[model samples]
Target: MIGNGCWFEFDEVRGKIIIDGPMTTDLSFAAEEMQKYVRRAHGMFLPIQRGVLSESTQNAIVVRIMAERLATVEEDGFAITYRNGNVFIEGNGIRSVLYGTYRFLELYAGMRWLTPDHEVIYEPTDRKVWIEERHDRPDFRRRGIILEGVQSASYAIGVIDWMSKNGCDLLMMTIEFWDEHQAALRPEMQARQLRLGLGGHSLDRFLSPGDYFEVHPEWFAWYEGGRVAAQPCFSNQEGIAFLIGRIVDYCRQEPDMDTLSLFPNDNKYFCQCPSCSTQSFVSNYTTFLETVRDQLEADGQSVRIQMLAYNAQIEWTMLESMPEAASLDVMVACWGRDYRQTIGSPAGDRDERFRRIVADWGQACSQRYHSSLSVYEYYADYWMMTSLFPPLARTICKDIEEYRSMGVQEMICLLLPYEKSVRIMQEEIMGLPRENNLADREFNSETPVMWLNLYMFARKLWNSSLDEAGLIDEYCRAAFGQHGDTGKTLLYALEQQLAQLTVYNTRWFKLRYTDVWIRDHRSKGKAVVTGVSPWAKEEDEPEIPAERSEVSRRIVEELEDVWHKAAHQGAHSDESTLLYQALTQYFRYVIQKLRSIDKQSSAQSKLIRQETEEAMSDLTEALQIETEIRGWDALHFAHRLRDPNVL
Candidate 1:
């Protein structure tokens, strides 16, 4: 024991994990975790006891859910302090109790929960543990993840467990599959006090055309001089009433649901009838939400309604006449912003518009509306930029700070799975065949770049002022052990190359096409137009420039040099070895892909075909290696590589 009170020591065989609060499931879970970790680290099982400890008990670890402490701490906040002869882990709520327990294990035992299935436990060399008094809370009130492309219950549960360990407070999924997952997911979510949110692009579910269009054709949207099932006719009072009734029923059925989205379909189709045409789509949407809110309130339901400021609803001018509801949440989806730059720094016209939209919503929510605001960011948008990992750690950190300054209460990002293999279900859901499914590919190795970005995003959400470099260094040392410095050097070099490549692949290509289109139209003495049809002639597309191939070649060489240096100079532990092997294989695939692209710009058709075949072969080999390592087929989405037409 140190100082006046006995601090809980790792090697304390007599220490008892005391549950001072009511024996709830979460508290019991926390105690069990503490007991389990202590046993794993010290080869000694600490007995867990209920109620108050005897006077003779010494060096005990007490866990409690102190509801009275809510006055001092947030509901998810926790405190660890030494009192008398015991160490107390007290929290404002049951979930916080689990959080406090994890923090305790992390700080004193040097335990790191790096991933869902992977963790690093550092045993003390001297068999002694140091203790400190700490109080902690998240900077963002709601740090969450919106589940996409994930199907398995086991994988979903794994994600929830990892979220609980990392202090994530909310998990959202689309309403279409809530019934499929809720039975398996609800218990786990409830134990962790994680807020369950359902609904996305699901206005159709509430007022689907299939169920009502035949009988009520007038209820559907009027488009191109005919009624379409794309959206409900917002001008029609009966249609709005039917939609609200369905929403109310859903809220009543899923009482555990914290928030429900009333977003339009994943398209720009809106009612073009004279009544709806009189106002913007956003104004009509606001009126519809207000009606729904009124009905929900009348029904005495307290579930929050989520609305999207996306696509057609992105313009701030559309929101001029909108009213606010305290229970309404405005999720500004930053869809088209350049991930290379922070939101405050506009990369182009689209980015500038998105920034303005975000700012307008923020100001409206703070000054006029008093409604909760959140950002739906796309850091891991695999669908848009397949198999490309942008270096967005600094951008992520800065973005969170900007959002927090703008009075945003929550930040939710779309994250891809880190699992090595997952089973692919039906084609309709995944959009890839089971036999040749690119969406179900295995990673064969750990994706450190993506993992680091995710870790940075989560940490920044909790503490905006966190030092990015320091955090990187900490993760590197923990992950790579003694050769962490070399690992850091390699990672920095990799990011630099990736930053250049990402710009070239995304921004430059976009600008190049626009420039080509403008030049072509000017040469023909025709007006340059927007929203060019997809049916435009293939010959109109510009060929890949020689300069792009040269740039890719230079990047490939740099990455190869970095990989070579790290492999030879950097010492390796089992973890580092795995990391390096996975990175090496991924780098090999990247190099081959670049070579294939370089060959595509060649004048010879024979060379292009040969390179394409070789690249495919390389990918197949990499996947085989991954399968050999994991002994299973890992489900990963990499449609770009799998599609021969893309190559």
Candidate 2:
């Protein structure tokens, strides 16, 4: 029953759907999305009419598009309602309508998109929806995730459209064959999206000796020896003008871009000339932005310029004055942070410096000028490359809240390269039998920690005041099943246990994880990688000691006990359960490594080897289950778990 107290049923019993506006490709896509869900609900697909509806048409879904001038809901916001016995989905624009369609299914039909393909849609026995009018918008304007490079995985998975439906409005990058693959996107995604350039550090590339340094060396930044094009001399009037011209030309080429990054070469080569020494870097940067702002305004363009205020370049002295037109947004980088503790907390911890730097930077961006602020976080690293889920929920959540408080409106959470964060572990030579229905969910088991964090990240973006325990509970229930509580207990326990490690003391947990990964890689000759979306690239491995094996031995025994006592273990083999066991197996190998180092007796070695083999067998089964569910291993690679250079 709707708010009007009338039952709303979308079955073959309803009238044909009608497009109430220009029947563009996006509208067609929206209609198709609605049609599929309708069929799933009633076992009958609804026919859609693009032409004028019949005079007598009744009880139909009408997708409406507002005029271009009146699109105040930004790009992706929408409104859904039931009126005059017909369902209506209206948007500020076509893309908004498409988002509305997805929202309808989510709120009224009990549909949850756990993954792009994996979903859980509850079938209503009565097939009746009680939808009060709902209008929704995002908390922030720039909501996005960078795929970095998985051109093949991106195409195969329909990642863009999935993002559109799931509240992502921006997709970054293009040099990686972007246009070539864009043809595969559905019409809705094509209509409502923006692609950002991460390679904004292009000043040197454009102002190089090969391009202009030879003609005018003064335009280039100076090192101890001489002028070079590696970085521009910010104080040089002519050079700033030249770089601005280059940026304008690039902007013309990519007119669809809304945010333009004016980042310089990613190095420490700033000008040391007498003129530069007289003033501050921030003041000089402000001058460059003022020039760009004035030029862009004259050109009648509203494109905004952003810069990376990174490292030594970010010293915070009082600005002489803010720019007349604060057209900049700084993307602050948080590097070498301690993942185990919140920024500024743990008083004497190394992260205190980071906390102070970010605080001062935030103030300068806000009080010092008209420029806005955003943050760039290394959400995933080398440690995250492994299957062990990093216990970073509390720390990251705290960061998000803190960033928001500091007036930062956007976050660019970058994960490392594909090899480290995109692949899963393989412990398979067998499959486990199940006795009941499984909790349905779609997740990248290979990147389980990141995958889990990805969802949490999205939630925090939408609502920063999150209940950590509640969020974990929902995630656990969705990713696992009846045993989710048990699994969550293990997850928290693991994170808490590892927090004690001096290894994870800093946000550089990635280095510590890599340390363990490479040491074990040599033990397992070659990894037989298969079963994933055909787009995933070949990916990377780690190990432990026999005296060390005692902890491993006990952990294996405990996990075994948990498995036996696990409620509804017959129902489904959960990811968390698999992850817990894999860690134990990896530790078992750790024990074996230590015993070998101690030169243990042959009899003792034999017993440890037997235990290792058993653990390996169990790991194989767990991995096989994971592969079956996630699917996308396009290449092969070694599992070398040793990298002395990483430490």
Candidate 3:
């Protein structure tokens, strides 16, 4: 390898790095052609010798580039050998520059790009497998967002940034408010801020509807609890038509609003007044759909309306009865399916509600009309992991797989509580192979080790056959920096924590639907009926006794101890400051309760309270110590590190 280096010479001519490797152009034209691919990969060229194929030369090049590399690739037709002082782009000719550019970007800071070399392994199976590549894309040209009052424009933009980073084709937003000044909550959403169309929901002022309701009492619907609710009654032809016309006008006026979604996916209750009661809810829904459709089509503009499958309209037959297919897009809203599993026997028929619904909708969409249908999956409940993630994923994957099999091309997840779960869904479960049935496997919850587990699952989404150990090695190096004793410790500890979290034996109940009521009943400090209260009973009435199980209490106490310890230890680590604060507040509240219970109970309660108080004090002190670690100059140092452009 060393002796072959002198056989070639390099020259920079006409903005190109040229190399004369040992092989003549006539003998290895393919190798020369391969250089084009290399240039495409690395974005630049670092020539390599045709004869010098030594491992050490390659390894040396690798180390040098790895020092401050942006991106990299390991394969033929695309090779950039970056050395201590220089870069070598290898290939037969100048056309390979594109490959070199790709390689340049594949490095960390420059542009950590995904490339063909990312495929670590490919086991050629003996069984015949039809390898038809299908690149699935989004149907809604603009994926829209509904920003309730709480989320600001900056927050919406941040979400958009994340969405764009992943694979959102387009971004749309709407402002929803509840009061007069509250409408100004979305003032940041100006024409300059939102590149896509913006929508406004003016229901904020329509809250008790004194004159509006009086003048148009026919527009209101009587809900289950004897409360009068409002629905734009299509039966009130003039008002309904005016509403539909305004919606169409809004769509036409808005820059990129090709789709108009009207129904509140989960919030809408049934309209039970006689005029609307006798009319098929589906028929009323169809009228609204048709009105919007006819107006848009007549204007030679395209728009689609989404109806929710919530409240009293869980029926798929609603879509079947609507004849004008060209008018609107039907979105079957799937929510609270996980909670449904707990209501009935988990064993009885496997809770096929979601799966069956998807199947039926897929059939209708295919066999019925020109307008398409998509799934609006809501992970609204924050405790999806503890309560729903496992089962929901299992059901969802099976259902989506079936839907895909049945030619349902588009699906969108309407997510809430967008924190780590987004990453979890993107990198783990959704990323895994369909055949792997990864949802079936309960993920290991060992903290740092679980990071490796997460990557393993994420790999499935991109490529099916990824090397688990190799990924762990890479991830460990990235997360902890070049694996050593510390890296091992961190990985091990993370794995343990993740495994601990996954066990679901903690004191916290999976809070979903009536589970919240169940928890409230159990924890109130005495025995009560277990499920939802009867219709006759007052909503706030404590029909159930407060009966916290001794076992559950112990579990909670242990978790509290862990949190307290974490808060204390956080003082020593820079990254743990936020966690420390959050945990400190949580532990203090819990610890206070631990003491309060002692006053009402026997000697055992006193002992538990004393121990818990000690833990809390320790944690509080630890937090104080963390505060001491910060200095006035902290902001200056942080500012320096914060701006990547400066550093």
Give a tens-digit lDDT track for model 1, residues 447-478.
55665666787788877788888878777766
- Give lDDT tens digits, candidate 2, residues 52-160: 5565666788787754433435556676667666787888665678778877877666665554544555334346666577666656557666554343645424556
Tell me the TM-score of model 3: 0.48
The TM-score ranking, best first, is: 1, 2, 3
Runs in model 2 deviating more than 4 A are 1-6, 22-26, 51-57, 66-75, 122-126, 149-157, 174-189, 194-198, 208-217, 312-326, 342-348, 356-368, 380-398, 420-447, 494-512, 516-647
* Winning candidate number (TM-score): 1
Off by over 4 Å in 3: 1-150, 170-173, 177-211, 222-229, 264-269, 272-279, 311-327, 339-350, 380-403, 417-647
Instruction: Rank all candidate structures by their lDDT, best first, as comma-separated numbers.
Output: 1, 2, 3
Per-residue lDDT tens digits for candidate 3, residues 1-647, read 11112112122221222233433322132233233433443343534333433433321121111122223322112345444323454432222223333333223112221111121111222211222211122222233333332234444555443332222322334433212222342232221122333333333222234655777655555666454545545466666665666666666765344455565322344476566666677767666666767888898776555554432222334433434343355666543343223212232232355555556666666777555666554322233333112212223323344445544544444333323333343343235333333222222121222112323322322222334445445543344332222343333332222222222212222222112112333333324323222111122222221222232344346645565454453423444322223223333333333222222122123223444444344334423332333211122123322442332
Candidate 1 wrong stretches, greater than 4 Å:
1-6, 24-26, 122-127, 312-327, 417-432, 436-446, 499-540, 543-551, 571-577, 601-647
- Which residue pairs clash in candidate 1? 420-634, 421-634, 421-635, 422-635, 444-626
Name the best candidate (by lDDT): 1
